[model samples]
Target: MKWLGVLLAVAVAVIVIYKVNYPSYSYRYRLQVSIAVDEKIYTGSSVIEVVWDCGPKIAGLGRCAPSLGGPATLIDLGAHGVIVATLRSGENISPTPDGAIDAVWLCASAFGYRSTNEELPALPHLTGRRNLSVSNLPRLVWFVNPADMKSAQKVTFLNVASVFDPTAHFTEAFVEITRDPIVVDIPNKLPWFSELRRLQKEGKGTLSKSGQFQLVYNMFVGENS
Candidate 1:
């Protein structure tokens, strides 16, 4: 009986240790986006899942941090009227003496037209040093009495910086982040997965010539130890 009790104690300890070292957590986002162009409003929604696990860490180097268990689920809003939506994910690494911080980000863009036959306007050239990075480009644009689809008329642009700017006074659009549980495998069954995979293969370096609206979402995850 004493030997049996000892065995039970050892089993419990091993389970606890495994749980601590291999912990997993995930966050799910349901994004709904609406864009108004001319007299029409276009809308779309997407579900994104991100999972992390507290993997092994080197001793005396840094704290134990979670690593992505697998590739994050991508977002594809599909075609809403003449507007087509696209999303892609990537990581940015910032190194430290002891470790490195990984910033995983998602970039969202949309292409729109008055009609399928109408040629979409070219994306405006980003001016000034602050606009150099693709991440810095505007997510939403408000056109005011455009002369034509191809005309480079004056328009309002909204990016991450401008959204937080006190003077920008952006009231029409907003981005939200929250902690919510999700089924990790749900994205695989989604109808848009094939198309989203194609976009992911294309990567962020290439911009769609037909793209007009762009937005970026960033989340900081594990540190390499």
Candidate 2:
């Protein structure tokens, strides 16, 4: 009787511990994007559907494209709409490199609101959402109408990656620029935003308002096949 009682106590203790700790954990997000192409004028709307924590292996995913890190604009000029979504899994990584894949290139440009002549703030950021806990979708440089001034926008240059490596494939799903706002999911709360912003405040990123942020380096945004 004593042995049986001890065994039952251990089982109860294990069950109680698991039940109490399980609720504290958060779930993963499975991002799914839907793209539509206009084919007539190279523009459209993108529907991004997301499913949480549904993955076989998280790292096994690929860059937006099979090889191209992502998109300079991420919009398929041929298609009207584009969708981008991410998933979470057990440390997924691509096993094979797509023949059409290329390195992620850092590109830059000036931002300004055309009609109002309002310029954007040059804020420094840690980069994409890769490992961070939260993703940040900042406004990119572009022209907008005065009446369209909804928010004081800020965005540096966009890093455009080519999948074709000047010799392969470059495919876009689809999208509309003026209408479709830039929506990028960064990692959770990043560790570098505060410091990067501090640099921006200290005028360390660039001295001139027009002075662009220099290309720090090309990060390998590679995904497994």
Number of the predicted model whose lDDT against the real structure is largest? 1
Tell me how far the alpha carbon of residue 196 in candidate 2 is from the true structure, in angstroms, after superposition: 25
Best candidate (score: TM-score): 1
lDDT of 2: 0.23
What TM-score would candidate 1 get against the native?
0.36
Q: Considering summed lDDT, which 10 consecutive residues are worst modelled in model 1?
A: 123-132
lDDT of 1 by residue, 1-225 (tens): 999999999999999887665554444334344444433444544444434444533454323232232222222222311111222222122232212112222211221211111121121211111111223222222212122112211122344223322233222322223344433332343333344445545675222223332212221111121
What TM-score would every model get versus the actual structure? 0.36, 0.21
Which runs of model 2 end up more than 4 angstroms from their true locations?
18-23, 26-30, 39-225
How well is each residue in 152-208 modelled by candidate 2, as lDDT tens digits?
A: 122221222221112212222212112123233221122232344356556674222
Model 2 lDDT, residue 109, Cα? 17
Error of 1 at 37 (Å): 2.0
- What TM-score would candidate 2 get against the native? 0.21
**Scored by CA lDDT, what does every candidate get?**
0.30, 0.23
Question: Candidate 1: lDDT over CA atoms?
Answer: 0.30
